[model samples]
Target: MIIEGTVLRGPEFDPVEGRVVVEDGAITAIEEESVDSSDIVVPAFVNAHTHIGDSIAKEAGAGLSLDELVAPPDGLKHRLLRAASREEKVEAMRRSIRMMERTGTASFLEFREGGVEGVYALREAAEGLDVDPVILGRETVEAMEAADGFGASGARDGEFSRERNATAREGKIFGIHAGERDPTDINPALDLDPDFLVHVVHPEPLHLDRIEDSEIPVAVCPRSNLVTGVGVPPIRDLHERTTVALGTDNVMLNSPSMFREMEFAAKLADVSARDVLAMATRNGAQIAGLDCGVLAEGRPGKLLVLDGDSDNLAGAQDVVRAVVRRAGAGDVSDVVL
Candidate 1:
């Protein structure tokens, strides 16, 4: 496969007029030359954190507090999920997955609920789709064993050493939520030595030091925090300390669109457009141990092709900034997954 366009090349996303050669789904080479196409080629997005199981509950609990909306077992989202039939849940999840694929997301790290069955349900929903899901099963060790990893609710919820140890023993990933509502649980969550953490919106000074020392990667979901009335995460600080990735947490709270996530992240943080784009793509891929986020030699040929001449993106002086802060799903011409 040969994809021609203005390729966003390498980690820096340098714009190069080129044609990318793909062999057996891996990028073989990028031949820089003038191409007669007004398409913008970029790495397909990797959403670092998501609770796609809540797809059935989109916009259900408006104006609810953070805990009232999604604080586990008794939250409104849980209630809605419990009320919905398994078939309904599966169908909803499938639609979300398809939307992701159409909008140029190649993969996502899903913090799936409903145990082992939840993992299998998501698999069923994604049956023939190109979008890959790195599912972290919640609730039980068996669920983690059945999926790619374990996703704990938070350190304040329970003692996760057993589950964390079990995941480590099985060579699977272990992740947890921390510092979303406050700084109290950050220490305990960090204590588990998780592979990654989600929603560190309130990391204190000592917590930041610990995170830096541990070198644990963090996946920030700023939109979800804002939706739930929690403060926005210290994205700039987190990025400076560790490998910070971006996620659009909870389909109920926000649309699962990387374009929207990137736009919000770019505007919310003082980081550069290139840095924000990397967080939405490569950093998340690194967190999930995927290798398709950067458009470089030997990497997977997962790419997003956008129409640079589209009404929304035309006349932009900076391609990276336009993609990060202005481009939308309508600008997408093709998703070469």
Candidate 2:
């Protein structure tokens, strides 16, 4: 297969008029040449973090506090999950997956609830879809063994040393939430030596120093924070310290659209468009241990093709800026995942 366009090549996403040649689903070469297509070819998005199991409960708990919305057992999201039938949950999750594929996401890191059954349910929902869900099961050690890794709710919610150590022993990923509502749990979460941390919206100077020293990657969900009324993450500071990726968080709080995530992250944080694009693409791929985030030789041929001549993106002066700050799903022509 050969895809020709204004290719966003390499880690820097430099715009090059070229064609990417794929053989057996692997990119063989990116040859520079002028082509007639106005399609914008870039690496398909890797959504770093999500709780897509709540797809059945979008916009259900308006004006609820962060804890009231998604904390644990009695939170609105959990209540809705309990009420919905397994079939309903599966269908809802399927729709969310299809929406993600249509919007140019190739892969996602899902924090699945409901234990081992939850991991299986997501698998059923994703059947036959090209989009990959790297599921990290919550609530049990067996759940972690059943899925890709373990996704702890938060450090303050419980002690995850056992889960963390178990996941590490199994050579699977272990991620935890921290510094979302406050700075209280940041130290504990960091002390657990998780593979990554999510939602560091309130990192102190010492925490930042620790992150820099430890070189831990972080996944930020800015839109979800705004919806929950938590302050925005210190994205700029975190970016300077370690690998920072972007995620859409819970389906109840926000749509899993990488375009929207990139736009919000770029505008809300003091980061360049190129850096934000990296967050949506390579950075997330690194966190999820996927090899398909950059449009480079020998990588997986998971690519997105957008109509640069579309009404929304025509005549843009900067390709990367247009993609990061302005492009939407309407401009997407094809997703080769």
What are the C-alpha RMSDs, in order, of all predicted structures?
0.7, 0.7
Model 2 residue 164 lDDT?
93
| Total clashing pairs for each candidate | 0, 0
Candidate 1 lDDT tens digits, 65-183: 98898888999998998898899999999999999999989999998999988899999999999999999999999999999999999988998999999999999889999999999
lDDT of 2 by residue, 1-337 (tens): 9888899999999999989998998999999999998889989999999999999998889988999999898999999999999999999999999999998899999999999999999999999999999999999999999999999999888999999999999999999999999999999999999889999999999999999999999999999999999999999999999999999999998999999999999999899999999999999999988998899999999999999999999999999999999999999998888
Q: What is the C-alpha lDDT of each candidate?
A: 0.93, 0.94
Off by over 4 Å in 1: none
lDDT of 1 at 131: 96
lDDT minimum window of 10 residues, candidate 1: 63-72
